[model samples]
Target: MKILSITTATNHLSVALNDDDQVISEKNEQDQRNHSEHLDPMIQDILTENRLSLQDIDRFAVAIGPGSYTGLRIGITTVKMFASILEKEVVGISTLKSLAKGIDQKDSLIIAMLDARNDNYFAGGYFGQALTNVIPDGHYHIDQLLEEIKKFSQENNIDQVVFVGSGIDKHDELVQKLGLNYTYGSESQNELHAGLIGKLAVNEEAIDPDKLLPRYLRRTQAEVDWHKRTGKPFAPDSDYVEEV
Candidate 1:
């Protein structure tokens, strides 16, 4: 099965083409440009160089959210559009999971974090050979996350752990201060290769493209700002708003 994957979920916009579990072609950009323009053409180029087309693809994959809103929207929309026309299956991979995949170790408790501003992060803990199950999802401050980490390790007796992601440096001081058992992802979490995205989605089905949606783990910035100014987010057009 050939799978195409995109990682517009972070600063690094990466794409990859995989044929039967092996990487055939890939592209990655850490630029600030909007993904709307870059994503499609990159896919086209990769396909062209490989002498392939949309018809040759068996599945589509994307890095779902807890990341840049624009990136996530662009990635989800683009993949969904192609999947719809081509009638292909799509899989949504987590940004954290993709980070965890980059690591080559297993004994360490994998702590994957993405900076979410305001001392909060999109973070999760995974501990296993393949990161089977280490923790739940949470929007957490660095302190709160560390607290949970300490508690879980005490109970499970897991001491070897590594933290991966671009957000790690944001809390570098704390991580160093605690002398926690950790190491950053290779390439500094800069290369979010789409190969990993496809790697994680191999078993999933290429379902109704319409069923695909971004895993928006939090509200958009505009929504959050509006809530702060008006004491509520965008109100739905309910009966309360429609009354004459």
Candidate 2:
């Protein structure tokens, strides 16, 4: 299968093109908040280098986030647009899951966090490759998430959970302050990775191309304003607002 995937659910943005045997091309950027500017050229370069057109792609896999709202939107929206035109299968890989894979936390309870700003984060938990407790991919103060993590850890007797993503840096010192056993990882080891996302996504059954989406944990300021303008308490449990 000629699979292509894009992931920008963290500070780093990465794209990958892979074949049934192995990856054929890949691109990534670490400059913070550069997805908007760099994503297009990066995708173009990858495709040009591989000598493949969008029509050649067999599957479209994307990191459906718990990361930057804008970045997640760009990643999913672009993929959805292309896939819709090409009628390709679409796969949604959770941003937290991709972060977990980056750290190879197959044996440990994994907590993947991406900064959601204002001292809040988009966080979720995985119990040894199985998603045990997910926060509905919502936003919460770090402390609130930490409390839940503590409770979950105690109940499961999880000694040391591996943490990754840009969010952890915000609470690194506090993690030690809380006396939590943890380790820090580099950007390459923490952020959502397209190579892994694409490969993993291909194993799943395809969903409607239009159903492809971003898991933005909280409402964007614009969304809030639109909701306020109309009079609706934004759906708390949902992550996406269908594009009009």
Candidate 3:
């Protein structure tokens, strides 16, 4: 089976092609806020270099966010269209889960985080050989996340905690204050990799094209502002209008 995967869930944009056993080609670049321009062409380049077409791909995979809202949209929308037109299987991988898979520390508490601004982070906790989630994925304040990690570690008797993802650098001091046996993820671990995403999705079930959507853990700032103005929940179907 052949799989094509795309990841725009972080500051990086990555495209990968995987044959039955391994990644054949991958294109990754740090293109913060320009997924629209880079993603499609990178996809085309990978396919072209490999001498394969969309018809040759047996499945499609994408990182379905808790990261950049716009980046997630760009990546998932592209997959939806391609899969729909080609009638191929499509699976969505959680960005946090993919980050966890990239961590090399075995049996250590893996805390994957993405910057959500204002001292809050999109974080999840995973551990052990299976990379099971100890803390469910969601948006959280730095202190709140640490508290849960501390509690979970003591309960599970996991001694080490490893922080991974692009957001880790911003919260170095806060992570350090936890005073556990801990380490920062490497640069490559901090960036998203479409190859890892494809591998993760290989055995997963595929959802219908129209049914797939980005997993934005919190409402957009515009969505929140709309509620403040009218005291009514923002309807997602309506066009978004940002208040000045």
- Tell me the TM-score of each prediction against the true structure: 0.87, 0.84, 0.92
Per-residue alpha-carbon lDDT of candidate 2 for residues 1-244, written as tens digits (9 for 90 to 100): 9888888777788999988527777788886977888988888899999888889999888888766777778888888888889988888888877777666655666777777667877777776655555444556688887887788777767767788776577667777765667776675777567887876776767889777777766667798788879997776666653322
Question: Over all chains combined, what TM-score does candidate 2 have?
Answer: 0.84
Q: Write the residue-wise lDDT of candidate 1 on 132-172 in tens digits.
A: 65766556778988887877877888776687876667677
Using lDDT, give the best candidate's number. Answer: 3
lDDT of 3: 0.86
The order by descending lDDT is 3, 1, 2
Measured by TM-score, how close is model 3 to the native structure? 0.92
Task: Tell me how far the alpha carbon of residue 82 in candidate 3 is from the true structure, in angstroms, after superposition.
Answer: 0.6
- Per-candidate RMSD vs. true structure? 5.1, 3.5, 3.4
lDDT of 1: 0.77
Q: How well does model 2 score by local distance difference test? A: 0.76
Off by over 4 Å in 2: 20-22, 31-37, 130-136, 177-179, 235-244
Reference-based lDDT, each prediction: 0.77, 0.76, 0.86
